[model samples]
Target: MYSLHLINKNIGKFYENIPFSGLTSLRFMIVDENVQDRESLKNVLEFLGYSVVSVAGYTEASKHIRAGENYEFIITAIRSDSCMDFEKFLLSVKDFLEDSSVVIASERAEESCFQSFENDEKIAGAIHKPYKMEELERIIKSVRQ
Candidate 1:
């Protein structure tokens, strides 16, 4: 079993058995409209040894995707009220993202189009907000696998 050292609330610091070398080469992208949440999650991911890039919204992230900045995994917050549409963005970049894993993060996860996100083959996992260490580790492990 794995454990953690909780930070504030949006993310967790994982001390799992994942090798540091294994994580160094993996790239991650975080997309969230909230700056504080994005930065906080980025810090924890970095501390756990993964390289992370953060963008405020899907539109900005899509630009990077189009530019060919590939990522092994992407964690996005799909909100019901956000101005951006995560589904639309994902569909637009379907070809570039075919092999990449996507994990959706949200507090209001059950309310939006994300309600059926797990059914989408593009997604690797989903975690509710007030993040938990196990869920984070589980997703990372799947990505590594």
Candidate 2:
């Protein structure tokens, strides 16, 4: 079980035991071509006690990696309208993604897709589009364990 705390910046007061990952400070980056989806997911993650940074496309996301920013988890869209190759993108950032969980989110992901990245130690899980909040939370918790 994890517990979350909210700290008041202005007063420098700490609100303890807010009911999510109290001990862990999880940072996440979201790479999705869809603006709406990216923002929506970012909001959900922030609400769930994660520090999230979201980018509109692979190019922007790569810039973050090039800058040497590290994240505890990365959630990316499998297929982008810009025709970015998901696997290639993953490989390109493998160096900066050490020990971080990678989750692929797609509307058309199949079992074969999961198997394809199964051997990659960074891949933590896959979620179909329109996933429930509970489902996403479950995957995150499972990977953390």
> Candidate 2's error at 13, in angstroms?
35
Task: Write model 2 residue lDDT over 1-145, tens digit each, in one string.
Answer: 6555555443344545444645238888988887767776676567766799999777778879878898888888887646568887887888888768988888775779878997888988888764345556667789877
Q: State the lDDT of candidate 1 residue by residue for 70-125, as single tens digits.
A: 89888888752265587787788878885688888887647455666767878888
Q: TM-score, each model? A: 0.79, 0.79
Q: Clashes per prediction?
A: 0, 3
Candidate of highest lDDT:
2
Any runs in candidate 1 off by more than 4 Å, and if so which?
1-6, 9-22, 80-83, 109-112
The CA lDDT at 110 in model 2 is 76
